[model samples]
Target chain A: MKSLQEQIAGLDDVLSARLGGTAVSLQPIPGSVPVIQVVIGGREELPIFITASETQVLCICYLWSDEEVRADKRAELLETLLALNPSIPLSAFGRIDKRFVLFGALASDARVEDVAQDVIALSDNALDALEALSAYLV
Target chain B: MSVIGKILTLVRGSAREIGESVVDANATRIYEQEIVDARNAIMKAKSELTGVMAKEMQSAREIERLRKEMIRLENLAVEALDKGEDALAEEVAGKVAACEAELEEQSRAHANYALQVGKLKELIKAAEGKVREHEREVAMARTTESVYRATRSISDNIGATGSKLVSARESLERIKRRHEDLADRMAAAEALDKETSTRGLEQRLAEAGIGGDAERRRATMERIRARQAAAHKDA
Candidate 1:
């Protein structure tokens, strides 16, 4: 069995091969999930945090949130986010650290390619959802 | 007929003739016109599709701008709150709220436009496919019409040639009948001439009493034989 770092490195290799010119680097943070920063399309770096336990490696991309969501629009935003969650594959909208985030996770036995693809999908869906829910979020 | 009636009759006659001529000469032109109409329709649809996509893009851009503004206003509100400026934080919060509401509406519009663009693109694609199919059908129809025309012409020519052959055969039969009739008449004339010549010789022979000559000669020979036999007996 490979370590979490090795699995992430494999995922990085696959992503680099699939997405030409995409730069993938691993940044280990003390006492927290290790972050994989991916630069795609020569744009801003998308940071993906990964946590590995005994059985599963979870991948997450922290999207925007409305911590100060107005009382009137909170229900509407929650509904919108809920509606969008099921539509985006391998991703969901949930509150994390006082902020709503769009995130996805995969099993430890999952292929690196699947993990990389899911990470890309999760990021894309997060950005898209943020754009979609921008008016509902503060 | 009155002058007005005559004019109306002439007009109707001319119109009918013109209609017939037009129909005869404009088959291919009509097909071309249909294709042109379909192409125009496709172009219009394509233009509409492009407009829908442009609207979708615009809405998406608006939503993206509003999202960025919301993020900025939220950060500003957070900073104001940290600095103990409650009024400023409230103002920034109000701005964030406004931006969020606008962003939500724009995002909804963007999603709707995206759906519209998708449907329009599919429609345009289907129309293009139909146009191509119709074009192929028109080409096949033209080829088939040409082949049909050639076959009709060949059939007409064969019919004409068949009639000519029938007439020729009839003429040959008439000539053959005439030849047979002439040969029969010549034979009859020759027989009549021979009988006319032989008729005088037979009449002369009858007139010279040659018909009784053989019987009379036989009787005279018999009488001489009997007299000779009697004389031998006397001797």
Candidate 2:
């Protein structure tokens, strides 16, 4: 069985290449739920993970405090992002604190670069990570 | 002397004169009559004053009662408004307005009721006109309804007669079908009789051996019998 850490690391490598501001690290958050943080678009790398059910990929992101994003607005962004990434099978989505959890599939054909760009577009920044992930997955 | 002072002096003099001698009958009589007359005049003045005060008091009481009633009505209107009972509020408002108008009219109508106001008759006349208009509307509706009912009855009768004719035609077709069925039975009986006769003839012909190898067999038997008899005789 592949460990959650290894899977997260694999996802991080894909996210880093697609997003490309050098991956700061691919380390596990020490807790019941597994989480991997990757740096894209300068300093802040967002956390991504597989949920407890492993039914979907949990992408947790924080809008920088000055960005002042409301949850409903963020949920709208997540919906847009999920729409753009046809490769990912989005199942469920939610917002906690300031982070968003997008539950969906992460397969070999997943468009990581486009997902990264969608994230950047959803944020104030414009970064396309899906393109970098395209070669790695295919 | 001026009128009131003159009357007062005459009254005082009459009182003094009466005190001098009750037995001086003429003077005493004048004094007594004057005193009674003065007392009656004073009493009349007092009664008139009392009447005026009483009327003022009654008017004040009426005004106070009207004020309290108006306050109560206004409060009721407000409460009705708060409850969103605008219709009720308007009804109460109409009543209050009518009461105010009536009060004004009543005030003008009297000093006393026998005194008439011009506006009162006009209001009554307008109200009567409204009632007449409403009655006219009701009568017109009744007339229209009668006409409608008459036309409907006529059409209904025609429709019913037509429907009855359709029903009768349907029944007549059913009877004709029954008659045709009887004819078909009679024709079937005739066909059956012909078939029976033909069958009887065929049975009789078969019994009589008209064909079907029976004649050939009979001829062969006769020849065989003859040959046997000839052989027997020869033997």
Candidate 3:
């Protein structure tokens, strides 16, 4: 079995290969459960936190807070998210600490490049959802 | 005001004001009346064209008559000169000159009349084309307006039906959830009954009577052994 650092290194290699020269890095945050901060793109990098075990790797991107949504428009915003959830391949909407998030998970044995692509795609979808629902946000 | 005074006041209104009021009061009727008036105008223009053509023909005949008259006077002047009548020839020559000038003026008048007739004919043709174009445009406008109204109505119906469909789907989802809950409850109840029922291992063995069967077989075997012993003693 590969150590957690070695697995993260392997993931970093895959991300580098898939994104060409887009600059991807994985930095470990010391904790009870293993956590890695994944930074992709340029100097103003968007960070995605990844938690991994021997069996699965989960990736999460914070989108917005519930407080940003207007009280009257919350229901419409939630409905739009629910309606869009099934169509967003390999990712789903979730709430944590009163903040909306986009997340996806893959088996550790699966292709890291494919999961990285999914993470990028999910991030784009999250940005699009924010733009579409901006009218309902403060 | 009295009815007669009201009537007199209405009669005293300007013709254009009365016409506008009538058109406003009876729009559809006025529209049909306008179509009739337009047709009458076309007929009147056609009659005017015919009258101009008739006047042109009369001017042509007058010109021909003046030309014949000038020729006759020239012939008379030539005959007076041949007969050695100098005064008569001179008088005829003067009449011939006067007739030539009159013919020139009449020819000019005839040309002007012909030009007017041609212009009037062209005007009538143009007016006819305009009338037909206007009729086609009005008809197309009416059809387009009707189509627009129908499309709006269909969109309204779709909006109404869309809401109904959404509510129906929500109701179906609710019913499905309730059915699943009821099925889970029934399954749980059946499992509970099986767990609490009093049929245990000893009760099932007693129902089969295994202990009674073993006692009967042992008694039969002992009797058979006793009979064998008695026969041996007697022998």
Candidate 4:
């Protein structure tokens, strides 16, 4: 049972060698449940926060909030998200409170390389999601 | 509701494993209560299975005891017949008959209990799988709640130059900017590559008076000028 911190550290090393880009920065979000934010280089705008529970290791990227949604198109935006869920291979459309997000989850014991790959896919998917669904935004 | 339907169906559908915010607190509470009820049901079934198994064991013991008593009575009857006591032998035979009947009843009861145990065990196995599936949903809800709190904290100020609160629109703009920047760099490098190609290098060398064609032309023009100057002076 590897900790989420160890997973992220392993992922950082893999991404560093594979990408040859700037190093990924891991910041801890001050919360009770131990969450860490991973900002990938060249895709820093879409920072991903990863956390763990007893059952799963979860990652999320906030696409937009309720306030950013067009006032008349809330339902439409949600419907689109539901429809778009299948298109993004590794990520899912969801919400954390009023803030809509693109997220991925793996078993608590998933491999570090798998998590790293998911992060990259998730980051790219999030950017594409925002662009594709910007019509619903204010 | 279908798994891919409206937001109202998100928590109750198959898509729950992927996670979505539980917008209705009341609904979520009822769902949690249902999980508790199912858990209780599983516990009840497990205890009932234990009781059935115990009964099966008891039936086996009774069958064994009755068989032993019947065997003893048959031995007595044989002894009575050998001594020519017909009435005593007949009485012993009656006792053996009674034990046989009792053994048959116990054997039947044991079989039924064994069947019930098998069924209950299977039921419990299936129920456990379902409960685990629902528990995963509850786990997802808790995780989503945690994410909500954490993201709420991070959403302090939007677009504060390296801040976490950057909006999606601004983030997209930044992504595009980085893409454009990379494109510009690539174009610049390609242009530099072309400028240093074999043709461009040869042209550069000609301008510097060290190449074949340009040196020959310059020398030829200089000789022509010298010849004209000499012919004019001679004339």
The number of the candidate with the highest TM-score is 4
Predicted candidate 4 versus true structure: per-residue lDDT over B124-165, tens digit per residue: 888787677666666655655555555544553233335456
> Which portions of model 1 miss their true places by more than 4 Å?
A1-138, B1-34, B155-235
Docking class of 3: incorrect
Instruction: Report lDDT (Cα) of residue B24, candidate 2.
Output: 42
* Better model by DockQ: candidate 2 vs candidate 3: 3
lDDT of 2: 0.46
State chain A's TM-score for model 1: 0.81
Task: Give DockQ per model, in order.
Answer: 0.00, 0.00, 0.01, 0.40
Q: Can you rank all candidates by lDDT, best first?
A: 4, 3, 1, 2
DockQ of 3: 0.01
Candidate 3 overall lDDT versus native: 0.63
Residue B40's C-alpha lDDT in candidate 4? 84
Candidate 2 deviant stretches above 4 angstroms: A8-12, A19-21, A41-52, A64-93, A97-138, B1-235
Candidate 3 residues A1-138, lDDT tens each?
Answer: 655455556666677677676667776655444556676654122356665544456676656666667899999888988998999888888754355667777776656666677667765665555556667776
Each candidate structure's count of clashing pairs? 3, 12, 0, 0
The CAPRI category of model 4 is acceptable
lDDT of 3 by residue, B1-235 (tens): 5434543443355533432342233543554466566677778878987887788788789889888998998899899999999899999999888988988887888888788888877777776765665454344333223222322332244365463212222333443566578789999999887776644544565567555555677788899999999999999
The residue-level lDDT of candidate 1 at B183 comes to 88
lDDT (Cα, tens digit) per residue for candidate 1, span B23-60: 23365476567778778878987898889888988898
For model 3, which pairs clash? none
